[model samples]
Target: MTLTNRQRAVPPSMFADETLMELPPPVRLTGIGLRFYVDDEGRGSATPALIRGQLWPLDTAVTDATIREHLRALVKVGYIETYSINGRKLLALTDWPSVDRGSRSRLPAPPSTEPLARSSRASRETFAVEGGGEEGREDGREEGAGEGGRGPSRDARDETEPSPFCRKHQPHGTDFACGGCASARKRHDQWLRAEAEAEAEGLAE
Candidate 1:
């Protein structure tokens, strides 16, 4: 397997995650180890034999059956998701934290599901920060902004422009407010709320 110089971050909240704590020790360890193996897009091969080879090459006791059981447990708790593309099984870290200065993955994305405000690319661009998780700069400014007086950066301008369409809400024009879009946004808000609650629980502990 080819490897890159990408750096990955483990959120502190991970240790306090109740669901993860309920998993068996070996399965939990395997889940954590798999995070390091995923590409920038948080995806990797899911075949049990291949996963065993990649994750436990020198450990004779770690059989392919053990790897498969661990994968099943991780999938059960939604720590990771497994899918197939063109008959090749693959796995993606469901909530993998973003890495700074990471290169884009060459791996194919998992099949599309309900469109969320935090699209796959957007999720990959966001990193967890102390106090709370926020995207881009804290002051609501794009990175690399010049001090001298200037108009909004290209990125800022692009953000202002309306998105044409997304996977689930496709074919809708810029002026249309499709129900699918609204439902996706609602689900995204719920996800944000859950994340905030999780973070708060971790902080309290």
Candidate 2:
């Protein structure tokens, strides 16, 4: 399917969506863009190349790999559901509301046999910490530590290490003044609050 100029509604609640808020900025933007890019029934191609071409044709910076990463993030948060149909991968929004105007989607429906891999709230938070940005070092080693440990040893550094640095705020030298880290902390606190409220509501119901 090709990209179309179809108009779609953007609900105000989208801005307050906890799951979307937890994702990286680029991933969140891509998720919102996909909402407008999909068909009336919220079905669309899952191919990274097609997604990049459809959503970011003019933007040279947005690459297929970037789109793929964004899509993976979106799927993890349950903003979209991906499935394979006859070996062709497609995606659909998990909670697409009914629309009156357009015809039904021509895309094949997702199979009912397999369950969608929607991450729980705790898992989502873990994912954010690990993959949200440059916060957590993959190797668990400081950047530029030599092979022979010329710099501070891991045990010595662990005692003085502050919060990890965010992608935007880096090389702060063990300081907890990173704006990205602050923002991430705020989002995480908000998620905790929301989870508590939701649990309370569930108990009351």
Candidate 3:
């Protein structure tokens, strides 16, 4: 789906790095990291060490692996840039778009976020129920295999409502754009780095 900045959701503790790892899988950890990026620094940009001391609660336990996993998820999502600091891996959010704000291009590249894989017929069934097929079934009726083989209840279907990852959200390109290799993007420009800097400074179009 097309997303304006307001429509996009970034979690609060995204920069928590390691501490986030302690939270339950997926959402909480990601949420913490999100907040860290957008909140603590006021820049949505941070290094793990730069953030650790600031994010922890007065008594929250700590570990390096937690920070690493948080960073790993961010890197996978394309929200952050990564590098090596001496011997340790480091990460920070993308400070600015590769080009100007609202600057139309082919399509901006989708972040490298890894899609979690779900296996198991039962699990797949659960996912399908929760996330509708490409058609996006709000009415919530399964077309096949109801009681013994009949369709599902309207209520059952409704309860199974799919979230964004529902097949419906991922169309060919309108949801995003192509990155030449089937990856998604807005567009590309040789001078993109310059444009990004100017935009970051609020001095460019």
lDDT, candidate 2, 1-205, per-residue tens: 4545676777666676655677888887788788887888888989988888877888888998999889888766557778888889899876567888877889986652122122223433453455433553336533333243232233432353233434444455224232245434443454445445434433454
Q: List the residue pairs that clash in candidate 1.
A: none
TM-score for every candidate vs. truth? 0.53, 0.53, 0.31
Best by lDDT: 2
Query: Mind giving the per-residue lDDT tens digits that candidate 1 earns over 1-205?
Result: 4433444556665676556667888887788778777887788989888777766778898898899899987776556778888898899877655666666877677654333334422432342222133553446543433232122233432343333333444555234433234333444555555445433433454
- Candidate 2's C-alpha runs over 4 A off are 1-4, 112-205
Clashes, model 1: 0
Candidate 2 pairs with clashing backbones: none
Which scores greater on TM-score, model 2 or model 3?
A: 2
Supply the TM-score for candidate 3.
0.31
Q: Point out where model 3 deviates above 4 Å.
A: 1-47, 84-90, 95-205
TM-score of 1: 0.53
